[model samples]
Target: MSRTMIAALVLVGLGLLTGCATSKDELMPTNGMTMQELWQQGSSMSAGDAGQQNIAATRATLRRPITSADMVEEQTRYTREAANEIHSQFSRLPNPDLVIYIYPHLAGRDQSVPVPGYSTVFPLYQKPHYAMPGETARPPGRTR
Candidate 1:
């Protein structure tokens, strides 16, 4: 290495060491607590030291009786009519159901009892379609 490069590196190392150093005045407490008092407080703190009474007081403060306004808010949040309004704010386009009726027929070779007729329904599309803004409020056919 050259002389100038080595001298510059030494100066930079010394500058970094000085930047990391702290004075005794800066370490002293500004909150009127002396070093001796701080040492005593630190020595008193142990593994079993816990503010259990403080926790109980906080819990008691938070556990105040619920007001009627709170009950009203909860009612609005959970009621079926409000629930539909909340969930269906973006009105969904109606997907008509396709009902297929199965006729009664005999089944099984050994026990050939007649199978009752039944109907099952499936949505017209694979997924429910949603309407755009200002679109029809209700399904196509019905009024009101």
Candidate 2:
């Protein structure tokens, strides 16, 4: 390659290396302040004030007052979220009781003893207990 092209490539490589060498402090300007201090400085304005401003802006942008349609939509959304939570909880629980009935049939070719038809019943889990949300799951035969 030409001398000028080589020098240009070297400079570009140096620039890239320097860019990658940036420290966390350099990336985020905390102004030599502690995390709490930085947070306080950044959040000088009260959250209530910001919320009010957003509410005012929304009110200004809205052409009409909220109607029954909007209320119904929000109610439906809440209902769906509640139903989803119930479904998640139900799914986390163990399966229900199961029963199996075997039909009366002949025994082996030797025809030793006839196997009697019977019904067996057993729970999906020995201990049908459920864990609350955010709780760790316990294995069978283990108790918390």
Candidate 3:
């Protein structure tokens, strides 16, 4: 084997090895929480160690009685926070398209499902309205 050919092969081997040495799983959930749990924890997390606590509090709100006034206020607050978080996150994400699917279910059989099991193949998503005037609301990375 020629010296030039051997050196080229060695360089290619080193490049392949270096690429495989990098870990894609660098980010992991803290406090021993599963990745599934963390993914469903939503985006309104506190900027402190109280993130888990905030998740619990949010879940509690889901069970509260919804009076007219309460519903209005709660929906307003939730919409605002959710929008800000979505904008911030989507700005950094590669694709901004959100695909939502809602599954059909039998009537009056909501309790027959197993615990922590998802029965619906498609879920409903409520979209919030955002108003942008003139060219100020142009999307990123595109020319008008």
Per-candidate TM equals 0.33, 0.25, 0.24
lDDT of 3 by residue, 56-87 (tens): 88999988877899889777755746555555
Task: Give the alpha-carbon lDDT of every model.
Answer: 0.74, 0.72, 0.58
Give per-residue CA lDDT, model 1, range 4-65, as digits (tens): 99999999999999977977667864587888987878766632236556667779889988
Model 3 scores a TM of: 0.24
lDDT of 2 by residue, 18-107 (tens): 999999887887677898986786666545787679878888888677889999988875574665665444334555788999888778
Best by TM-score: 1
What order do you get sorting by TM-score, best first? 1, 2, 3
Clashes of each: 0, 0, 4
Q: Please list the residue runs of candidate 3 whose C-alpha ends up more than 4 Å from where it truly belongs after superposition.
A: 27-33, 43-144
Clashing pairs in 1: none
As a TM-score, model 2 comes out at 0.25
Q: After superposition, how far is residue 50 of candidate 2 from its true place, in Å?
A: 12
